[model samples]
Target chain A: MTETNKTWVLRSRPVGDIKDGDLELVESPLAPLADGEVRARTIYLSLDPTNRIWMSDVDAYLPPVGLGDTMRGGGIGVITESRFDGLQPGDVVNTGLAHWALYNTLPGASLAKLPTLPGVPLTAFTGPLGATGMTAYFGLMDIAKPKAGETVVVSAAAGAVGSMVGQIAKIQGCRVVGIAGSDAKCKWLVETAGLDAAINYKTEDVGAALDKHCPDGIDINFENVGGEIMDAVIARLNDFSRMPLCGLISTYNATDPVPGPYNFANLLMRRTLVKGFIVIDYFPRFPEGIQQMAMWLMEGKLKFETDIVQGFENAPASLSRLFEGKNLGKLVVQVSDEPK
Target chain B: MTETNKTWVLRSRPVGDIKDGDLELVESPLAPLADGEVRARTIYLSLDPTNRIWMSDVDAYLPPVGLGDTMRGGGIGVITESRFDGLQPGDVVNTGLAHWALYNTLPGASLAKLPTLPGVPLTAFTGPLGATGMTAYFGLMDIAKPKAGETVVVSAAAGAVGSMVGQIAKIQGCRVVGIAGSDAKCKWLVETAGLDAAINYKTEDVGAALDKHCPDGIDINFENVGGEIMDAVIARLNDFSRMPLCGLISTYNATDPVPGPYNFANLLMRRTLVKGFIVIDYFPRFPEGIQQMAMWLMEGKLKFETDIVQGFENAPASLSRLFEGKNLGKLVVQVSDEPK
Candidate 1:
């Protein structure tokens, strides 16, 4: 084990788009684990759009990350040293605020043990089978409440939560439409994820495409991208439609506040409902969501695609891929060479 | 009784502001009552902004009024002649689609008998104690769900539904802020309706006044005026705030679609909920709502104000009063003399 660690810190606020200069790579001496802490080495780091929301000082479901702080992230790690009785050395666990660091000390309460699977990749614990999967599960079933035969539209349908939302809506017998940035992602959504239809939003006119694909109009919209796509979806919502707002990835890197088309009167005309939700609020139902998701995965009824980058040094670039729409699925940075 | 009766018909759709020329007073031969129908004299006409929503060809809670047809309205009338076993002569009853006419024949199902309240004004049956009271009752309790100590803000505070909402919110132990068009209306809301605070939105900045009145922010917003006032309220919503949407009087007479600020993203940040409600949806609870409101009125816990315009021919001007914000409380046009 190395006595020194490499960590990435948010050097300054991004102006328009985050660049390499916005992040600083620093080498620091590893600190000893306290009595209730476990020293862990990063294996896989989760890259999500919520990181952008956390970067700003705007009030949100969670508090914003302060400048100069180690960029907050979730990761799967292997315990290298443990002063906590519940965890032992070599135990793979999950923790948040896990910077792009090789070694870090985490409180015992902040870590959850990851169980090994025979065929599933270790990164699955950080992707579809983890927070993203749970977010989709609860946001769809609990919030959107998509009924059988109803049309469910998911924005960013090839990405983490969006991918799961499309597949889960399909499982619930809903007609699902997936919207993604690339044609390849659209094809994958239709072919592998079992979505009824897919729209390459980058290439197609979203409102016109939605009109062609969903003539009955959207009954449940799992909103991930929140600027123009949201405006289009809002215009086409069926009466009594439900929108489970999970993320607004489209406006994450925006230097200026995104202005809406502001057709809120449509909500009244269509009698539609839009609710914002966070996965943490549904924590009590996590076991039920995880079990159902696991069963679906085991039965081969659910599929997850992940974009895995090779090393910890690639974390910054890998995270940027999310905002650029370059990632096709759950984006993860492999921090170490650890076997499943 | 006159063999012929006068009825007001829609001459043409209003180009800008609704004028007297848009409606024509026409004489029609009186038709005899048929089975299950009663020939009635229009005694009182209820003038409301919702009538404008019904005038347009657009789809809404109720079907739009066909052009060249008699203007549709709700009114209390004496059944001068009756073939229906449920109704008797001289009986005052409530009915819909009752034109701004002196006489008309209506189905029994479309009418409810007005209970006798000796010495109480007959116009009260056509005002706050009528559909307006029912709207306020259901919109607030069933939809907004204001809790004790929570701040409830209502627009058009001196108007029909608004006045009831403020009094009811006070009854529920909520701190109430009423927004009205004039200084006198604001004074009425505070001194008579027992509102915690009242803002003359015509004279004061609504958003800033709301800040002064409700420092913690509004928990329940009873939306009647849906333009800039709605925009202002949206900006000050606390987390999990509920908006019970009833009417948008602000846009009723708008010849062109009124452009709204549309601050929908605020809903996500505040976790706010805005729901449009039609009182008919709460029909099962109508008896309860009516019984409670009636008791409150009798006990002087609920005070009602009526702006009555005498004479049936004056109905057009009376209806126009709602759009101009000229009437206080419920606006009603007295069509005939009340029985001694």
Candidate 2:
């Protein structure tokens, strides 16, 4: 059989915003799966802000993608052929940090069989029940350690991890406020996600909005969108406030070196705790996070959105959805059809 | 029977670096002490970087000195007379957040009496045994939690808190690296404070020096001086590193808003814990910290430096010693004669 694999290959490191030709879609013939290997056709490809970090030749949490190598990403796929035990064709699996390709030939041991939860769709494996959900879970629960009645503020409140963060904080019995780019996103955060309040960062003065909302001052800052929004939050943090630094989406596409929050001195004055973390660090605890998040989902307490951009050819261009605030919640690409 | 007291009174809030008219040496007739009040003559006035912070009308750990009020400071003083039960004439006490005055009339109940340690000078109270000492102790012990083999990096390594931080880490059996302004201060940190290495930030490429000294990467950063030096340290932090941010002396005098470390994103990439703290927060546990630090001092495991500037008139001008990096260690102004 002459099956072909189409993959996004890193042609050059992105200078600032990812421009054309920095990555190229290259086609190659698929190789035969060896013993203990599995062939899975991509169903959903997770496009995140961190993807921009991976394409840069900088020291990030993970090594930058090597020039000419397959563009690294996270995705969910359905097994087409398997040579290892406990696996069969048509079984869905999570390709942990896999290639942005139509077909991924991975070691069967490395792929986790996606658990089937009632009423949960396959796209959720790329969102609330997957890496993004886990990111929001541990970042808030473990780092922020929210307590009842505490004021919790989350940036990028309309984005994947952020939406979950606000909902989780609300579940924890805290007064949650969200910061998002658009008024529509802000409305969704308060109306759908049940945040105490939501600020439209693009149209409103974030500092003034935060002041009006967080009268008692912010006890926890779930930092995602850094820069001015972060500075505004930092300035309003209460004494001994906790900040779980999940992502700096605002600085991901910058050409020059990004300076930290302008009100960084407030961190000292307020005696705040600022911690930076990646969700992958809590991989071992994913079962715990997913189980808890799943319970909330089943209870109708958690709501999530998946902004799916279809086609394998659109992977690179689709990443701008996150940077430009075009995506409502989780941004992903539908590379192939989900099993019927 | 008319004795007068001279005080450094806040005339106007300083915009950046404190100027001559921002504070004035105002002399007023001393008020007669009421019951439960003590009259103390200032022995040593601590001239610290935080003094500059208090001079600015910005929100800080404590309320900024109100215009026309006595400038807020920490000092050691000899009680001339006391009406409260425990404190009496000739007793030395710590005037907690008192005024920068020749004589302070304070409530006797609020004063902490100084214990006479054999061979320990009064100057030591301002250095390794006072607020600055407590700043280093808790910031390192409670926040950093240094391990035996860990590499600890401290900026402003020759200053009051920094010097003690390096020594405390040394006692913890960690490789301590110091970052200071001068070659002389660098020599003192390595030779006298027993630091493993010292980087002259002014004369050396701090990043290159850190690379050469800290082969294992920095596990704890006792951040006293924030700016370029902080960025250099942040870039090389080990995974799960802890940063106890005690001070940001480098930016205290900036006329414009000071931007944080350019490599701030590395804090996330490295999963670093950055906590801003003030020594006053650890007041309840001071006895525990002082006990351990005092034990090390008596065991010859800890050494300290006191950079004394003479006269009450020079108190305002002497604060420049900290900003200009002219002081070797603990900078204090000798306000009045020490009791014989």
Candidate 3:
């Protein structure tokens, strides 16, 4: 283990898009774990659009990550030291709001012991079978519950959570169409994720493309990108449809208030449901969700891709890939090697 | 029987406010009833905010009303002539989409025989126990499902659907607060409808009043007025809050597109639900809904007020009451006298 930890400190609140100097990487001496505490060495630090929210002073589900504090994030790590009976060295744990660093130490109660499955890589725990996977699972199954023969539209179809949501809807016997930025991502959604159709939103007219693909009308909308794409999908919603709002990456760094869907009146006109959710709200049911997700993974019914950036030094730049649509599947930084 | 039937025809789509010239009252020769059809004499024409939507070319759940067609509406009246086995003269039936007329003839399949309740006035069917009431019934009980001890906030609180929503939420043991446009409406919401608190939006600071009344956070929001009032309630929503979007009367006459709640992102953050519906969707369960509404009315557990505008000539002006926040309860236009 290194004598010092590399931690990203919030130097300033982002004005628009997160820039290089918004968060500064600072080296600090590693602190010894106290009683009732455990130390986690980050193996895979997950990067998400929500990272931008915690950095802002905006009102949100959670309190803003204090200025000069280590940037709030989630990761899968192995415990290197434990003073609590529930944790031991080499135990892999999943964290909700850990610091963006190589080493994070807190009371043992703050960590969750993730159940493992055979042949499933630890990185999978950070991507598909961990919080990201659980978010897709609960948001789709519990909230949207798209039935067989229904048409489902998912934006950000190439990302970690959106990819899982598309596969799960397909398993439920739905005709799925995904909206992604690039033609390559659209191709992966149709060919790899087994979606019925994929619309390259950047090139194709989303509303017309949606009309062509979704003749039966949209029964469910798993929205990640939230501006015009959201409005177009909302306009095509069937009566009594459901929209599981997982994220709004489109406006994450806007300096001013982003105007909402002008056609939100459709929610009233069509009797459609639009619900926003965070996975931590389902923490008590995480085990049940993980079990279902693992079964799907083991059965080869669910497929995934990850953009794993190497080295701790590249973590900051890797996060920008999410906003730029530069990364595919799960975005993560591999800070260090897992324990032998 | 009268030789001529007075009916309003949509002459042209209104640019902003619905004008007298928009709907021309036309006199048509009373046609004989055809096979499997019945003729109904309009007693009470139920005026609603959706009347404006059907008039516009905007994409909606139902198709736009064609120009020169009888203006679409709902009404309660006695069957004057019947060619169907299920209906007879003097039998009162409810029609979902009758025109603003003195007499209407439609296939019996289009009419629903509303159950008779002792001590219940026919106007109650147009007000609290009819389409407007059913909208409040299903929207609150089935969609929002505000639990006992939760706080419910309603916009347009003194209007037809909003009035019923407040009472129903109260019956479910929820603490209710209402936002209305006038001090008189606010008084009626508190003194008559039994709301815990009422905010006069025109005079009171709604956001501050809501904070003071709903210190525990709002759990369910029955939004009838959209735009700013909708945005204010959204900011104060509790985690897992539900919003039954019954209408957006505030923007019904806007010539340009109305912007939605800026804090709509709260739907994602708090996992809140926003759903819109029309009463006809619950037709299969109308008997069940009417039965409950009747029982509540008879027991005096539910109270209602109808802003009844007499004379067919006053029908067009009555609708404008909704946008102007002039009606106290259900806004109804009585075309003819009710049977003794």
Which candidate leads the pack in TM-score?
2
Q: What is the TM-score of each candidate against the true structure?
A: 0.92, 0.97, 0.95
CA lDDT, candidate 1, residue A321: 89
Ranking by DockQ: 2, 3, 1
Ranked candidates, highest TM-score first: 2, 3, 1
Q: Rate the local accuracy (lDDT) of all candidates.
A: 0.81, 0.91, 0.88
Which tens-of-lDDT digit does each residue in B130-205 have in candidate 1? 7888889888988788789999999988888899999999999999999988888888898888999999887899
Give one digit per residue, the lDDT tens place, for model 2 in B1-340. Answer: 3299999999988777778899999899998889999988999999889888988878899988889999999789999878888898889988878899999999999987898887788988888889999999999999999999999999999999999999999889999999999999999998888899999988899999999999999999999888989989999999999999899988888889889888889899999999999999999998898888778888888898899999999999888878899999899999888888
The DockQ of each candidate is 0.42, 0.86, 0.78
Tens digit of per-residue lDDT, candidate 2, span A66-139: 99899999789999999989789989998988889898998998877888888888888888888999999999
Interface RMSD of each: 2.9, 0.6, 1.1
- For candidate 2, give the lDDT of residue B83: 81
Residue-wise lDDT of candidate 3 within A1-340, one digit each (tens)?
6578889999888888777888899999988778999988898999998888888897799999888898999788888889988998889887667889889887898876776677777888877787889999999999998789999999998899999999999999999999999999998999989999999988999999999999999999999989999999999999899999999998887878777898888888888888889998998998888889899899999999989999887887788899999877999899888767
Q: First chain TM-score in every candidate? A: 0.96, 0.98, 0.97
Ranking by lDDT: 2, 3, 1
